[model samples]
Target chain A: MDFWSNFLINLVQGLTTTLQILVISIPLSIITGFILGFARVYGNKIIFYISTGISTTFRGLPLIVTLLILFFGLADLKIYLSPFWASILGFTLCGGSYISEYVKGAIQSIEQGQAEAARALGMNKLQEIIYIILPQTLIRALPGVSNEIIYMIQYSSLSFVIGVKEIFSVAKTFNSLYFRSIEIFTTVAFVYLLLIAIATLVFKIIENKLKIT
Target chain B: MISDTILNVVDLHKKYGDSIALDGVSFRVRKGETKVIIGPNGSGKTTLLKCLNLLVKPDKGRIWLGNIEITDPRININKIRRKIGFVFQDFNLFHHLTVLNNVMIGLVKVRKLKKHQAYKKAVDALSTVGLDNTLYHKYPAQLSGGQKQRVAIARALAMDPVIMLYDEPTSSLDPQFVNEVLQVIRKLAKNGVTSIIVTHQIDFALEIADEIIVMHKGRIIESGRPTELLSNPQNILTKKILIRNFRTLR
Candidate 1:
């Protein structure tokens, strides 16, 4: 009974940490993704080269390696970052790289006439992007972006590695204290499954509302 | 009488790698005149229309709209493009937007009209093409080919452009639907909007065009009143192609 109570408390703490990271990281990654995506598609030589390089580097590295480098190497430089911040930076970089490709592909799939038609209507380049290009791209990219969001939620359990008290971290602490690894780890996995199921349900609701086929 | 010179092209040239699409193409279109360009494949009629809108920049020579020279590469192209409407063979309406929104986009974004004002103009444009009631709320996929083409016209019309360009507008439509789109173009021509059409519909061109140009190998081989050119062919290539393709109508 004492072990059971400790498991519940640790589980709650882990859920809280997971929620906090998602709340901070999702919006930041989306904004960064959109900017980099647009730069890759329409920017001139310098911006295109820089954005491509950054996206490629992030995409190539393993998530574990990225987290280790940021947490350990940066700590030695006296640029100490909290585990929360380090996890967020690592997740955001990976999310941005994946989301940027989604955006770039969506933008490219639009018909060339859409842009020409906008220009013929007197829209300059910037106005064309805002009023015509971006709206259409967003709708087309929603499915791909939604998939990325799901991936982000699942992989966010990795935040526990750097000592953040995320869901998995709480499961680890509960197991060590109670010596009931099966019960605690099974509970942790079930919580993650529940989180993912909820995320998928919410996305389905949005898809219905938007009439996205 | 409408002015005799609304648009002029002189010695225009365009090349794509080894192939020359337009070589020394020149013509003058009067204000309110409906000019038709007829040619076999690869004769550069489509290329000329693309140049007028600066979609494909010309390599040499000049294009003039009244006294304004449009050939200067550094000019504000958006301003020039705004004055002309282009209807493509494939319709090219935004599939994601409703017919109303597609028409309203140009008005709101380019003309800087308020949302209400843009919507009003789009409604008016749709009504002109006789598609206002059924299509305003629907996406392009819901409409038939004829309805979609009319919406494309409405989208162009909402810009309130001075001239309109049609590149084989009826070519992509079903036989039954083709006349409906042609009727819309005929109505616009009667309303005195300057128009340049590149088409293979010889009978329709003959009925509507004020002047007709016959092109061969990137050159205007014959140009005159439609009746004059269609009745008597001066060039051997024009005579041969017309006899082969249009002898039944003649």
Candidate 2:
């Protein structure tokens, strides 16, 4: 009975930490991703090369390596960031790379004629992007972006490595304190599954409402 | 004479890599004239029209519309493009937007009209093309070939351009749907809008075009009023092509 109650408390704490990371990381990653994506698409050769390099570099490196490098490197700069912030930044960097490709591909998939038609209608470049291009790109990119969000949710478990008391970290703590590894780990796994299921349902509703394929 | 020249292309030359698409192509489209360009495949008819609209930049020569010379690299192409309308062989309507919104997009975003005013103009344009009743809320995919082409026409007309360019507009439509689009073009011509059309429909061109230009190998082989040129073939290419193909129409 005591083991069951302890497991419940740790699982709840883990769920709270997971939710907190998601709430901050997902939106920040999206905004940064979109901006970098547009830069990759329309920017000059130099800008395109630089952004592509950054995105590819982060995407190629392992997530734990990136997290360790950032945590240690930033500490060396004498600007010590919290474990939560470090993990957030690491995940965002990784997420931004994938998200940029999604956005770039979505923008490119739009018909060239659409832009031509917009130009023929007297829209300047900026107006053309905002009114015609962006709306269409957003609709087309929803599935890819949603997939990225789900990946981010799963990967937020990596926050445990940097000593951020995220779901897995809380689980680990409960196991060490109470020697209830199986119960705590199982509960944590179920909570993660529930979070993902809920998110998928919400996003699916939005996708259907928007009529995005 | 000066004001009659609505669009004038002088020695326009455009090359893609090593291949010359438009080699010294020149023409004058007077106000309210419906000119048809007919040619075998690989001629520069479509490229010529794209140059006039600044869609394809010319490698040499100049294009003049009214008093504005459009060859200056720093000049605003979008402003000049606004005055010209282009329709493609494939009806390039925004499939995502409703027919009404497709027409209204240019009016609201480019022309900066209020939403109410843009909607009114969109309705007026649709009505002009006789599609006001069937497609106010329908998407392009829901429309037939004829309806889709009409929506494309409505989209261009919503901008109220001074001259319209049609690049084989009816070439992609089914035989039954072709007449509906041609009829709309005839109506536009009758209303005194200058139009330059590239088409393979010899009979339809005979009925609607004031002047017919026969192009072969990137140059105009024969050009005159349709009655004069079709009645008397001057070049071997024109003779062979028209004699071989247009006997039924003739």
Native contact recovery (fnat) for each candidate is 0.60, 0.58
List RMSD in Å for every model shown.
1.9, 1.8
Model 1 lDDT on a 0 to 1 scale:
0.86
Worst 10 residues of 2 chain B by lDDT: B241-250
Off by over 4 Å in 2: B132-134, B248-250
lDDT of 1 by residue, A1-213 (tens): 677786788678789989999888887788778888999999999999998988898889988788878898799999898999999998898888889999999999999988877776778999889877897788777788778888889889888788899988888777777778888888888988888899888877877666622
Q: lDDT score, residue A22, model 2?
A: 89
Model 2, B48-114: lDDT tens per residue? 8788888878899888888788877878988888788889878877766889999998888777899
The CA lDDT at B189 in model 2 is 90
CAPRI class of candidate 2: medium
Share of reference contacts kept by candidate 2: 0.58
- Per-prediction tally of clashes: 0, 0
TM-score of 1: 0.95
In model 2, which residue pairs have backbone atoms overlapping below 3 Å? none
Query: Could you give candidate 2's per-residue lDDT for residues A20-62 as a string of tens digits?
Result: 8889989888887887888899889999998899899989998
Report DockQ per prediction, comma-separated: 0.61, 0.58
Error of 2 at B188 (Å): 1.2
Q: Give Cα distance to truth, residue A206, candidate 2, Å.
A: 1.9
